[model samples]
Target: MARRRASNEELAGLVQGEQTDAVRRLEDRVAARVLGDLESRFAVLSQRSITAWVAAFGSVQAESGDTAALRRILSTIRGAVRRLLGPLGPRAQRELDQALTDAVLLGARQHAAFVEEATGRATRPVSGRPSRGLRRRAAAIGAAIADRRDRALAILRPSRARRWSDVQAGIGAAQSALPATRAHIATTVNEAVNEASLTAIDHQGAQKLWIAERDACVNCAAYSGMVVAADADFPAGLSWDPNQRGRGKALAAPPKHPHCRCRVTAWEEGWAPEGVPSFPDSLRREARRSIARGWSLPTESGAARIRAARELLRTGAGLPKSVEEFAALAVRAGRFTDRTVPTGP
Candidate 1:
């Protein structure tokens, strides 16, 4: 017998799995690079700090310590640390930006190929300029690193004793901050991959998308069967879109939190089944009620409006009015807030 072609649902599931794996691998690679850079820099800085401290205060007893000499030593250590870390900000931003861009573009191409194979339609390649979200995410990573560096500086401040013990304690404290810093960078990579995947799906002309929650946690379970239009805002605003609040204020798009395993799948109009039994019934009822209460529809525009309304009914949000509006809302809701980004050191 001839080999059977996979159904649309099967293809979507396969793509989702593959995309998740790809993103995870990319994240791992990036995280390793970041951690390595941080470790190397920290080790060198710590050694230099120790050498400077030993030369300045190794023999001086606490009681006989010259205050001015201690100040000069601390200042030298601070300057050395600052100089060593200065290049990290730009390096990290560049690494993250390049990695995210490459991952997203690769994801877009993968989505386009799968779409073409499943539909037997020749689809256009995603040809737009780089996503602005990439830039914003890069800047966020830079800011996070700066904040961590500041904290490390605070920890390194010389105590009144100016003893060798004090210098060693400060170095130890700064080193202890590394694990949290690594986790933060890892989370940034996770979010970038998600944003890129979603962008790729949209560029492939998908009409609908659905969240495939990891289903391992309460938050993920609540969002498990949620679906949205290709252009609908994710993590739908709580004040303006109360319906999506069921997923929780903390839940907005995939990678809802660090180490999130959720994925999104896309569908074209005819490829997907009409009935989505998995969707929550309460939301459907609310959508219908909302449409009923809206302004009157024009007779000529009735069919189009009805289609839009039906889409909203299914997804729990109106179809995005325009691309610009969708982009704005997606960025506002999908990207991480300052509080979510980790501050370590």
Candidate 2:
């Protein structure tokens, strides 16, 4: 009986370890491929349009000739957008084209209509050139935008929803395998250390962390990387391919705050990387380090932070008590406290 019980525990650990390794390996492959494509796309957009847009906006602020200024500003804005979202081909183009077109065309038409009503003759307000050419260009641009949006919208339902569903399903399938992965690790650990019995490492919480980091990867400018729940057991860096570009770190203990189910996911550029008002780097640094330190949550403030984290995670910010319960469990896990923060080059 003792032998059987030992076998069962050993089996569980083996299973957990295998699942962790396999999922981590597979996730690395998927993330690298997908994120690389997106990064290339974003880099292209950011590089081409930002300069001209900045110039135009800057010129306008400096009180350049109003008409020329308006022309440059409008042209810059239009060009920037095209540079950002220009399709790779039919493959990437879809419903988003229509949305873009609808918005751009609707805007251009509004401007043209206003211009015609006021000036009577169709002429460029600033250039004295016939407005026909400009309006035509605007119309074309608008249509292009709309076409892109349309394409995006059309495929969006299937591509995005389905992709997400598939990943989630993959996550579910992974749950059973975690024990296998952990078992291997447990055997290895058991040989050397007898600290604690291995339990389900925060698999659910890891998924949540993945989801959060995914969002930051998509939208956050300063995104450095993700710090996840202590219980969630994020894939360790040494365990993964060193070639993967992302930075990963382990927390010392569970989260101290409510719904703070995970630790901080830092972006390299910090928040508001699109040149909007941003948080102070020092403040951000301090906040991340402080959170990583694993102090107990200060009742109300901790609760609010947890709620905010949930909101950030898009988990619908469930009841405060629920978030708190999860957070407290994390605290008990003793995994949240210490972590290394990587500064990206």
Highest-lDDT candidate: 1
**TM-score result, candidate 1:** 0.56
lDDT of 2 by residue, 45-108 (tens): 4354345434644531243334554454334434433443344222122222222233233223
Q: TM-score, each model?
A: 0.56, 0.25
Q: Write model 1 residue lDDT over 1-345, tens digit each, in one string.
A: 223334544453455457667767877787676556667776876677666666766653343176776777667656755665566566667777777666666556655655565555665446333468656866676666666566656755655336766655555555544565455555666565455556656765564443442222223333444566767745532211233334445333565655665555455556433454222232233233323222221211333223433344345553334532442333335421221111231
Q: Which regions in candidate 1 have their CA more than 4 angstroms from the true location?
A: 1-16, 32-37, 40-80, 113-125, 159-193, 196-217, 235-252, 268-345
Clashing pairs in 1: none
Report per-prediction Cα RMSD to one decimal: 14.3, 27.9
Model 2 gets an lDDT of: 0.29
